[model samples]
Target: MSTVIEIDRLSKSYVVPVRGAGVRASIVSLVKRKTRTVEAVKEISLSVEAGEVVGFLGPNGAGKTTTLKMLSGLLHPTGGTASVLGFEPWKRNNDFLRQITLVMGQRNQLIWDIPVIDSFDRNRVIYRLTREEYRERLDELVELLELGELLSKPVRNLSLGERMKCEVAAALLHHPRILFLDEPTLGLDVSMQRRLRTFVEQYNKRTGATVLLTSHYMADVEALCPRVVVIHHGELLFDGKLADLVRKFSAQKTLVLELEESQEDLSRFGQVVSQEGSRATLRVPKQDTAEVTARILRELKVQDLNVADPPIDEIIDQVFSRGMA
Candidate 1:
């Protein structure tokens, strides 16, 4: 695959005015101001290939949004360089903008009183799509997102989930080759989140658009991205396969056991995470997983048992904690 997104020491920063409380202090600060420089994105370099779905993972204020904004040509970087589709992102060229799209979960680009399809039409015009192309793409998005019923409804009348579906469709109306999704599933119910994830997967497969997604929901990352890039404090921490991240940082394994009898204490084998009628979940050291599994089978009445890696979120937490340390 060809490299579509190439970032070399990309960085961003901000300067903000500082002020203190009290009328006297505020008046005195009118003439002489205090200011500080905040680094939103430290020097970070990464390369993404065409048609790849890579997860961008970081906590709040970790510069995930800042990086995406810079890459989408919405913000100017303080230092370094980035090239998306062989165009400098901060330059905001029309050719570059036409080939990429950014969907922010917390923000909306649709007009409030207009119907969802009207908003999509607005984007269709902005991207200069022909009537037939617009209709074909709209139909495909409507079927994939199940937006046939919601399109004619006013944007104000739609619920958060419904509006989010429309927002994604509007962003993709032009069939951009690159997608920057920042928390696209935020504030949605479990079913809605799953639906959006499925739609994104289908869109990528159908269009072959490269995706750089930043989501707090681990399920989104696990489902869509084979590779993940972790950033903390505006610095790169890890960039590798999802399974490699788990293997490198995670120290524990999870064992799920189905007991023939209920209410049995299994603390001697490992740390009991949870237990219910005839079933228990344990967290055991990775090194001791095999031995504990055998011992549990030897001692307890086990109808069924399974061993698996710890949850992805837990492994990610470990990654951030260790990186901060």
Candidate 2:
């Protein structure tokens, strides 16, 4: 596959005013302005090939949104370079804008009072899609997103999930080759989230569009993105397969043991995380899990035992905590 998105040492920063409390400080800040530069993205570099789906993962304030904004030409970068389909994103060129679509979870670009199809039509005009092409794309989206019944209804009457479906359809009306989805499944229930994931997977498979998605939900990343790039504290921490991230960040495995008696202290074997009645959970180093489990089974009259990887959320927490430390 050809390279579709290339980011080289891309960085973004904002000079924010630091205002002190009380009247005198506020007055002083207005004139002189105590400002601090917050680095949102710090020399991050990555590349995406055509027809690839990559997940951009980070915690709140981790610069994920800032990076996406820069990619979509919503914000200018402070340093480094980015090229999407050989066009600089900050230039906001019509050719660059027309080949890419950005959907922010919290921000809706649809007209609330208008019908969903009308909003899509508005995008058709904006993208200058030919009538036949527009109709063909619209029909496909309607069928895929199940938007037939909801298209005629005003956006305000639709539920949040319903509106989101329309929002995605609107963004894709032009059939952009690249899609940037930031928390696309935000505020959605489990079934709706799954449905949206399925739709995204299908769309990518059918159109071979390159996608960059940022989501808080691990399930979303796991389901839709085989490759993940993780950023924290304005810096790139890990960029690889999700399984590799877990393997690298998580040095310990969780062992759940069902004991014949609840009186034994298992802290000697490892860090006992939780214990309830006859069931206890312990975090043991990966290398020691096998030895510890064997010892526990022989000595503690263990009824049942299971070993598993640490949750992705915990691994992420560890990564960020270490970064902070």
TM-score of 1: 0.95
Cα lDDT listed for each candidate: 0.94, 0.92
Report the Cα RMSD per candidate.
Answer: 1.5, 2.1
Model 2's alpha-carbon lDDT is: 0.92
Give a tens-digit lDDT track for model 1, residues 1-325.
Answer: 9999999899998999888999988998899998999999999999999999999999999999999999999999999989999999888999999999999999999999988888988998899999999999999988999899998999999999999999999999999999999999999999999999999999999989999999999999999999999889999888999999888888999999999999888999999999999999999999999999999999999999999999999988887877843
Would you estimate the TM-scores of all the predictions?
0.95, 0.92
What does candidate 2's lDDT look like per residue over 87-109, in tens digits?
A: 99989999999999999998899
Angstrom error of the Cα, residue 95, model 2: value is 1.6
